[model samples]
Target chain A: MLRKMRRRITIRIDMTPMVDVIILLLIFFFMTSTFREAEAIDVQLPHAYAGVRIPKTGVYHILISEDGKIYADNEPMQSREEFIQAIVSSRATNPNLIFDVKADQDVEYGVMLTVMEDLRRAGIVRFNLSIFKEAGAW
Target chain B: MAGANVGGGEGRSRTGRRRISIHIDMTPMVDVIILLLIFFFMTSQFKEPHGIEITLPKTDVPVKIPESNTVTLRVDENNEVYFNEEPVEEISKIREYLIARQTENPNLVTILDVHPSAKYKTMVDVLDEFKIAADETGVTKFSLAMKREETAPEGGGG
Candidate 1:
């Protein structure tokens, strides 16, 4: 009697389903992910009903805290001269640059006015005062 | 785990009876995907903040401001609010006054004369009131001005 011995078998996996699921997940993430501009400091904005949506591009941010500290693009500056220099340099690159002044509600009006004066002396004419919109104020 | 052994060596011929089966565990993959989904969801900011435009008055250039169609709202250093030369007893009165003024002149412009020493909160509150009034009465234009040099009245009305 002759006996037949079975050869060792190799198993294979079809990766089509796994690849399909992974690709679907990749597409979902790509669709849902949002790329937002970086904010250096947080501010407690005043609420108003006449607030408008400011343009996202071509804007410079000047943040003022309650204690009269000034920050340009999140970097604290020593004097108005520093602010003027920064604005001049930034304005050279983008002529249409508009300043977005965000001042805390508790800050004295004089501090804000002085900042605005410095910006104006730097030749920045167009700017927005950042404010949060009050709900149901339309 | 229940479907792990469904297709284990069932299609083998009699000669190849000893067969091996392959299984891919998807629990770890699903866990990773869910973690990534949560991470993306947590870091994303969906809404943009709002703002109101303010043009600073030029020190060198003097422009004539028309007084005919303008309503002046002043906030003194003591935080007393005056609407169109009249003292406002309550903040809500600003809305009512603006509505009445809007009926008389549709193209009215509001000028805010804020004192330098005035509290920023008071100015903001007044601005908020103006905004509410504008929204209710359909007045679109407004401006901020520095209060002219004048002496405060005796015994300050707070």
Candidate 2:
């Protein structure tokens, strides 16, 4: 009993497994993660169940606020002419740029369509409309 | 293990030959790695962006569809949905109407004509329902009609 009392119990935990897992996760995130640019305007995107995953790279954002304000790639435009000019300049640098439009749900359909008409006039045939995912049966 | 022993003289083996045990202090490295991991986890957008693909016509010319073969849906400013000039009680009924109409006429084309003052969400909701109906009937022909005269910008001025 004296010998048993003299010996002290020591507790040790091996952190190798945890460190290994963390390193693996770090590498995974490093490979797959892409940083998103800060948005100039806030928009409450509409929810739809038919939304498909859009490509993250080579995307130019077109944001439309609730008050009919338009932002091209976080740059506020004074008018539709300025918006078109911005698109034209951006297209010069990146020919493969795909516009991804994010309009607030409260925005008027007229404003949105007028923007689309301008895009059409600018020779842009295809674009993506950003939306949130709604929970539903796929 | 705390520090690395680079040819330390204090370590000696039983054979009288000099020996050393090298160890690396992993605490600092681990701390940095953990910090990076947390930063990435917080900054990355967890949800992938979802969107709908749209293709517009190249010219200002409009394509005409037969009146009898077309079903025009009108959504007013108050979120009121009208099906072929008839008011619909609920938006959900659109799916049923489309499915029934498509079954009746295989060549039927849908046209969405939303009022300028209508909310954008109403159009999206209607499009979603149209997609559902299209999925059921395997027909995807649809058109978006908008008024361009009153709001048209004639001058160079914005």
Candidate 3:
């Protein structure tokens, strides 16, 4: 008597091309995406017509809250003296440091001036005040 | 016997084929990637937060600001703006004054002296007015000055 024969079927899927495309897309997004810098405090900047772009490097961000609270690099300072000390220490390492003062629009001008005075005392002459661009006309 | 023979023949025919091609649907993946691309494209900002164009005072080294053809503006504690020690009733007056001044001098330099007790917004508004007026007439020299701190009064214990 003759024995019955059996057959086997095989299936294959190539994931190489699909994976290559996915990786390319991921890389594109990763390279192009830019994350907003985290701030220690929030400030509503005043609007001005003479707004100009500032360089990103060597900038020391100082945030002034609406209630006149001072923040340096996401850390709250107890007083202007403390803020100045921090700036002096940072400036010792980086002489080309540029202070970027971010003050709330509603904040009293006296508080902002005090901060400026402190920065001056710290030997930081080169500083920029952050302002929003005016909407309609220059 | 015939049914058994037919079943054996069918089984032998089934073993002839191998290597079946598998297809994975990538439409869903493509859709998701496109959505993400749109999201990022919309959210990305090219312009950095801008800074006011006026220069600040230096602590150690003081630069000589030209007094010739200069206009001095002051903002008081009550947000009142003064042009050359005279109170300005409207912002347009400032623009008009600068334009008229620019026509005569052409090299007009505007100096802003802001009081410490004034609101920050008031200072910005004055600056904005200055900027508009200066730009309209092609005047570039501008400086921001801080009010001198008050000296302590000589007195006995209260």
Question: Quick one: best DockQ, which candidate?
Answer: 2
Give candidate 2's whole-model lDDT.
Answer: 0.81
Against the true structure, candidate 2 reaches a TM-score of 0.82
In candidate 2 chain A, what residue range of length 10 has the lowest lDDT sum?
Answer: A7-16
Error of 1 at B5 (Å): 21
DockQ of every candidate: 0.36, 0.69, 0.35
lDDT of 1 by residue, B3-68 (tens): 544666544443455455666776677677667766766776555667766555445544454578
Off by over 4 Å in 3: A1-32, A135-137, B1-21, B27-46, B57-70, B89-93, B106-109, B132-145, B148-158
Model 3 residue pairs with clashes: none
TM per prediction: 0.71, 0.82, 0.68
Question: How many clashes in each candidate?
Answer: 0, 0, 0
- C-alpha RMSD for every candidate: 9.8, 5.7, 10.7
lDDT string, candidate 3, B47-155, tens digits: 5778764344443444454567678788888889999999999855787888788788987667777787888888778877777776687776666665455321111
Can you write out model 2's per-residue Cα lDDT over A28-95, one digit (the tens) per residue?
A: 88888877558987799998877778888899999999998999999898988888889988888999
Can you tell me which runs of candidate 1 are displaced by over 4 Å?
A: A1-38, B1-22, B56-59, B65-68, B77-80, B85-93, B119-121, B131-140, B147-158
TM-score of chain A of 1: 0.72
| TM-score winner | 2
